[model samples]
Target: MSDMTMTAAVEAALPKAPFEGRHLIDGIWRGSDNGESFDRTSPSHGILVSRSARAGRAETEAAIGAARKAFDDGRWSRISGKERATLLLKVADLIEANVERMALLETLESGKPISQARGEISGAADLWRYAASLARTMHGDSHNSLGEDMLAMVLKEPIGVVSIITPWNFPFWILSQKLPFALAAGCTCVIKPSEMTPSTTVILGELLLQAGLPVGVVNIVLGFGQPVGALMAEHPDVDMVSFTGSTAVGKAIAAAASVTLKKVALELGGKNPQVVFPDADLESAADAITFGVYFNAGECCNSGSRIIVHEDIADTLVEKVVALSKKVAFGDPLNPETQVGAIISQAHQEKIAGYVKDALAAGARVKLGGAPVSHPGLPGRFFAPTVVTGVTADMAIAREEVFGPVLSVLTFRTLEEAIALTNDAAYGLSAGVWSENVHTCLAFARRAEAGTVWTNTWMDGFPEVAFGGYKQSGQGRENGHYGLEEFLEIKSVVMRVGRTRSNWVRA
Candidate 1:
């Protein structure tokens, strides 16, 4: 089907007028106190989709107050783990029920392909479900090894109110990454989703209510990062802050939250590398390489934006990647055939273009697409899938996180050189290696200065595994048992038998 037909069908299936883009505070949908609002334009068509309230310090304060009150009341936090698990499961069910609507809204706002959006929706539901299971299974430990004179134990308790700041790339998915675990840990939270894509997250408020979540347990404030996100990090009542965004912003948050010494978990940016060996399956590696960087228009934190190929197959692999890049369908996000859709905004598109231009000027060659694309019906921001060759490890394009669909290629003569090139980046979130030699792949994976490594595959992993970063990329894990533990504080208790106490000068 044509892009227009697909767009019409999706809109017909899920109408958009019913959604109210506003701050969800204490279970109420209200505008900012100053009545200031901003238009949210669809990236697919550059048309106004909704007018979202521009929340500021006032709203942030209100959200913090509501979360504090809810945490203090202990209405939700005092509940049994099984009860919280039941409610979380309900949320997962509700998300699955509205999968189509959720997927459509995400695509309309973010301009990712509808197919990928659907998969994200499913992944979110699974994430919530997994968190629900953790709610019941999570427990502390008792120890009798200290001595018969004393009884000791450790208890895991909620960390009170949390301020969660999510990014725009995967609006709902990233929020799901933090929210479910926080809720499972019996903590109240206030969410600050990226202003560029706040529609679906605002829509999620109603679903939370439908799932029987208590009011003020989950509050949402919509606005730009400066006031909303900044206020959240510095709020005194907030016991912890969890953020997912650029490394620079994450650093700012860390510095701000340090004043109160609150627990902070940051999932920051990455400049991931994909290393291809001479003995690897060239075709499969090529496909994985393309998907690694191009998926979500390469606007992923752990995207394999850098490729380090062995010199022997470097030329042939570059040719294959360039050929695959040319075939990437760029059009309306609703179309199933469209591999890449509109970028988040025109400014971001220009930023990506600037990166490519700078790389070209710095003695690099554009092996494939290197410019913006203009389609007849799709009037929004769009950039072509790009690949650059002859880039050094020190180039700006090679060093910085462009966060767009632009991959830079670098050649290495030996395994040691490839490892060094991959580890040269400051950020170390993830890496991809393609090699038929198991010993070599294992050794490279062990030596790579990244949090996670994919062997012969990219971005293939389960939620049960812990995922995080090293160096400047991030601080803590985001999934598995570790993710749930991030929201809880450990308390050690010791008791004296028969009221025995050590007396020195008194008593």
Candidate 2:
């Protein structure tokens, strides 16, 4: 009985693991210059979970320089693919061993449920293993037909130093998808994690050192976006920039990198669509839609904020969605039974609430939720699950990314209309087609303007599958062999078997 109460008390308190410290450079933890620091707040508690060093322009520059020097001086880039593969697999083993600690940190920093955090840990570990195999498979090309008796081959080499700027949402997962593959491709990186959530990133940097990565190969500059990320984006020493965030900021990064003619890969935001056909199983469709929009408190880049449903089943789907929304339990993230946790911040929660207000002002009806709940007793930043029906294609709430638990419901008639509605957005990261017919699924896959198209599945991603966006959603893939290439550059090596250039021309 005493042990059970202890568990209950732990659950009630929502005990968050602390990671109060500064940036890690050259395998050492160091504070920011001028003794500067920033607080990382938990959405579940709205209090500082940890205090980390906030890098200024000088610190950012220092990190970039350190990374450049690491790549130029260290043997990481010159290491054979087989050796790199071995180290990568070792890192994967370490991450798997420490999965619980990482998961708890993620849960505390992001206010996601602990169970979900564990799943993220597993997914991240899988990426490391995938990248390890890809390291050995990181080959360019060799050809015999280029010239008779001539040997010509291409080498995919590291693109010097890289700056990876990740956002607050999915910090661990995004960095996992990025850093492992970058290291696999023999590239050193200086990272600037989102200021809002920096605890896990800082801790993971420490873990990399423990896993045998060389000093300065992975530097952390934990600070705000404007100075830290912006300066890194335009840094001349940086060879490439891989960003995962909003499209607006991605454009700025692209512009910044263009000045130096460096490579840039962006995995930006999306107003992704979820199409529910009349023939889709309403039970499964409602469950899928509920999780699609509300997972991570609708903070995901590919969250299905816009739901385009067939007019034949619109009312029925709405009813089923309302029922499912009622069943979604919300509370402290540490509780295993809590399906929904707090939004990332109070400002973000209010931002999501404003969408519901505007949707109502635009003549849409709130099918369910559409309100905010205050837990004055609890420290977490919580918001209600909301669904707005009677939405049109052009409405701001339907078109813009709410990035909250609010979902907009709109109806369509024909296949063209459905496809047109799905394609109408300015962003196209991911999309889903809910149907039992193979023909319709194939057609949607062909026509949908998205990097990832899921048939009857929403928000499904694995380590092996390549993920990114088209157009404004951002460039490049994030997983598997495709992602490893983003951190590499190709060069052609030409050789002749028996003839010298001068001898062949003059004789």
Candidate 3:
């Protein structure tokens, strides 16, 4: 399809009115007590897409209080596992029923392709369903052989009120990654979604209410991180904080939560790399590399933004990857045909451009697009798919998280060198190795410092598999059975029958 046709189609699909959202506190929808508000413009369309109540200290505190009360009073925390599972399954059904609506807002607010947004929203239902299964199957351990008249048991109990903060790139998906798991563990929560992509989270709130969740079991406060997220992290009433965002912000949240010694689970930044060897299938590896760097315009924590290629095939692999990247569609997000969309904002676009510029000045060469480009009849910000060759290990572009659709190429001579280069980065969220040899794949998998290792593939995730990072990539895990355990505290109970226990003190 022509660019002009795609632009017109995107414009036609634009929402006629912005989504109006208010805070969901104590099961009631209400405006900010101080009458503060914020507006979110569609990053792909340059038009207002949502207007949300800007929560302040009062609203944040109130939400925290409500969650604390609900958890302490056992409104949700003491419910039967079957009851929680039933509620979660209903939510999953409701989410699937409203997939198109949620996907549209997500695409507009986050500038991801509408098709990808639909897939993410639709797939999020699976997370809720998986969490439901966890709710039913969750168990504790019991010891029956301690003695004839004595027994010991270990119980998994809810961690009380939790604070969940999600990022903008995959707002709905990430929230599902946390909220459902927390709920499955019988914990009440206060949520703070990124202001840039707040609408979909608000819509999730509606679905939760429609599913008949009790008051204060789930509360959402909308605003910037300074007040809304800061309060959620540090509040004395909260027992845990689960955050997904930049590494810098994760550190701040950790510091704030430390004052009260609350538990903190963070899925932070990643400068993940995909290592390619000579014996690998060049065609398949090149295609996966292209998809990895450009997916969601590379505004992802797991973006394969850098590649470590064996020097033997570096030139050939770079040629194939560049050609494949050029074929990937980049344009209006509302158009189903467009594979890549706008940058989140003009400032982010500039930041991406600045990285390429600095790399060039530092002796790197741009083999493909290295600057921002305009789309026909579109006012939104966009950066072309960029690939930089001759990038050294010390270059900022190679080491830092650019968070854009920019790929850096570096060469390694041996398997040892490849693994070393991959592990050199400060962030170790994930890594991928492409090769036909079993020894090579296993060695890379075992030696890599990342939380997840992909052999002959990239970015393939399931709700049943655990995910998180190591080192500066942040602490804790999300998804799978481990995700549910993140919101639980273990307690040990000892019982003595027939009053057989001896007393140390004289009666």
For model 3, the stretches where C-alpha displacement exceeds 4 angstroms are 1-11
Per residue, candidate 1 scores C-alpha lDDT tens digits across 273-303 of 9999999999999998988888999999988
Candidate 1, which ten residues in sequence have the lowest lDDT sum? 1-10
TM-score of each: 0.96, 0.94, 0.98
Q: For model 3, how does the per-residue alpha-carbon lDDT over 327-374 read when each residue is reduced to its tens digit?
A: 888888988898888899889999999999999999999999898888
Ordered list by lDDT, greatest first: 3, 1, 2
Q: Per-residue CA lDDT of candidate 2, range 1-507, in tens?
A: 110111111334434555786887776788988898877777776656778888898888888888988899866888888988888888878878887877776777788877788888777888889999898888889988966758889989998899999888888889999999999999999999888778778878867888788888999988988799989888899999999988889998899889998999999888888898988888898999989888987899889888899999999998888777777766677777776677887788888888889888989998777766754446667777788999988788988888988889989998889999999988889999998888988898899999999899888788788999877898999896788888889899988888645555574
What is the clash count for each candidate, in the order shown?
A: 0, 4, 0
Q: What is the C-alpha lDDT of each candidate?
A: 0.88, 0.83, 0.93
Clash total of candidate 1: 0
Please report how far candidate 1 places residue 151 from its true position, in Å. Answer: 1.6
Please tell me which predicted candidate would have the highest lDDT against the true structure: 3
Better of 1 and 3 by TM-score: 3
Best of the two (2, 3) by lDDT: 3
